[model samples]
Target: MDEVVNAIADPVRREILALLRERPRTVSDIASRFTISRPAISRHLRVLRESGLVHDELVGRQRLYTLDTAPLTGLAEWITFLRSPAGWQHRLDALETEVRRTSRERSTTPDSTAPKENTA
Candidate 1:
């Protein structure tokens, strides 16, 4: 999941993914639309492949790349969970994650204690 997130972090890589999303394209087909060198685009494609967001197949002499959206399912669900505002429980969970991250960074244990049960 981190890999997928990191892969999409770059605008150039995001554009490559968008191109592949439409249809499978060869490296040249993808590189033609960008100002970067073909080698640079190939490097971006390698990152996408490692992240499981893209798949490459050898068709004759051409290597075709296609988008694989399966890896994005978990990411999409997490985004949806974070975006929901109707559930206090959902918001609390998100807050807990942020708090724990902060606590870990500061090496403090403010949240080490268990959360009190809500009986209201």
Candidate 2:
């Protein structure tokens, strides 16, 4: 998950991922989208490669980068866990609703055990 987050943290890297998600692109092709130098794009590719977010293959003289997409499994798992019924936010909301319901019930129902106080 850390790798996935780190890979996506950079806007350039995210753009690269978005591009490669559609189709594999050459380093030069990827570099062309940015105003940064080719070397700078190479550095981003290195980070993406290390993060397992991308993979490269040499096709003849050109290196083609493709999205690996395996590292995203951890991210998806985390999102799924957060969206599940066991998540804290959902539990807190439910607890709050129950408390409000109980409060409303108490407000509406007069206490039978206590003596009624006279209103001025």
Q: What lDDT is obtained when candidate 1 is compared to the true structure?
A: 0.93
Expressed as tens digits, the lDDT of each residue in 1-120 for candidate 1 is 899999999999999989988999999999999999999999999999999999999999999999999999999999997777766877898999999998788686455677988999
Q: Candidate 2, residues 77-120: lDDT per residue as tens digits?
A: 99998778776778898999999999999999988989888998
Q: How accurate locally is residue 16 in candidate 1, as Cα lDDT from 0 to 100?
A: 92
Alpha-carbon lDDT, every model? 0.93, 0.94
Clashing pairs in 1: none
- Give me the displacement of residue 14 in model 2, in angstroms: 0.5
Question: What RMSD, rounded to one decimal, does every model reach?
Answer: 14.7, 6.5
Count backbone overlaps in model 2: 0
